[model samples]
Target chain A: NAGVTQTPKFHILKIGQSMTLQCTQDMNHNYMYWYRQDPGMGLKLIYYSVGAGITDKGEVPNGYNVSRSTTEDFPLRLELAAPSQTSVYFCASSYGGASTDTQYFGPGTRLTVL
Target chain B: EDQVTQSPEALRLQEGESSSLNCSYTVSGLRGLFWYRQDPGKGPEFLFTLYSAGEEKEKERLKATLTKKESFLHITAPKPEDSATYLCAVQSPGGGSYIPTFGRGTSLIVHP
Candidate 1:
């Protein structure tokens, strides 16, 4: 199982620019999540999806949006990039929505907003 | 609010020197605690999960123990290859979100 995969390992965006981060999982997980990790900080949830066509905001979902069109794909969208959004982004998935389920993470995408 | 705090932000140890990393947390009705190891430029790999206080889990040279308020990851006779950033997280059963709150992580460097 390829586990989870993310695109554009590294990206640089200018102020006000918009982009979409793509994530796909082959494990057929029912839950998918997007998180950002800053230097000297823990991973903060940005958005999550419980299933296809069902999405919800996470802890830091102010400038981000997400869609789960298929069980294998969950994409995160940034409407307006800012310097504060520069960080490493990770996509994860789990078989279920319970706390006991283990999440499989992707390689991560490093974003630099100038 | 649920919070996780890890100590000794960074630690350097000689090969064969054992050490323990601490993760303290505060939450309402704890559901689970998790430990992960992350290498540079890669995503984190799950190590262990503890469900309740007094529970312990081990893999290879690493052992994780959980308590009512904290969790400890102990490395025994570590080698240089075992160096990585160790992260701890906690999940509560409240609010119906079931999201895990992670710690800043403890960076470990083993010198040969």
Candidate 2:
């Protein structure tokens, strides 16, 4: 049922450029998260939203911003993209905030900054 | 700081071979441990969840067990399609937060 979908399957940006990665979910989940995966490193949380209009910083939030304007969308923004920001980005969603709640993830968005 | 570590960064197995991947964690207050499978260029897919020590969960050829300090994902008679990265994550005791600390996944390659 198209659980989660991310746009721009791949992108290449020059240094100092700005871009936004789009993520949408059809499950009407209340919790959404943005994470980045680097080589040999685990997924690092970038930002999260508990619900529409509610957002919070996560473990790694530098050089990025997020907005949750609706129940079905959470977009991650990259301002002044840098080489360090080049990585595979993932968007995930869950029905609740409980520890037992399972998170469903999208395919992924690969971004490269030169 | 809450941390999660996985052993054997990469593993190569033949068809029908069985092996186990380890995930060790250190957190102030444990809530739940999660296992996920991720294929190359794709996001992680949920596999199992273990809430307490001595708890076990099984799905297909994968069996996940939890202890006080570590968790193991045992694959029995795995096939070529089982090749993927296995990730381990833990939810903290903090209320109203679903944030999970994740470990570098164990990349598994099963040859047919």
- Every model's DockQ, to 2 decimals? 0.71, 0.77
Reference-based lDDT, residue B34, model 2: 93
**Model 1: per-residue Cα lDDT over A1-114, one tens digit each:** 889999989999999999999999999899899999987787898988889999988889998989899999999999889999999999998876554867789999999999
**iRMS (Å) per candidate:** 1.2, 1.2
What's model 1's overall lDDT? 0.91
Which 10-residue window in model 2 chain A sums to the lowest lDDT? A94-103
Off by over 4 Å in 1: none
Best by TM-score: 1
Cα lDDT tens digits, model 2, B1-112, are 7899999999999999999999999987787899999998889999998999999999999999999999999999999999999999998756558578899999999999
- Model 2 misplaced stretches (Cα beyond 4 Å): none
Supply the TM-score for candidate 2. Answer: 0.96
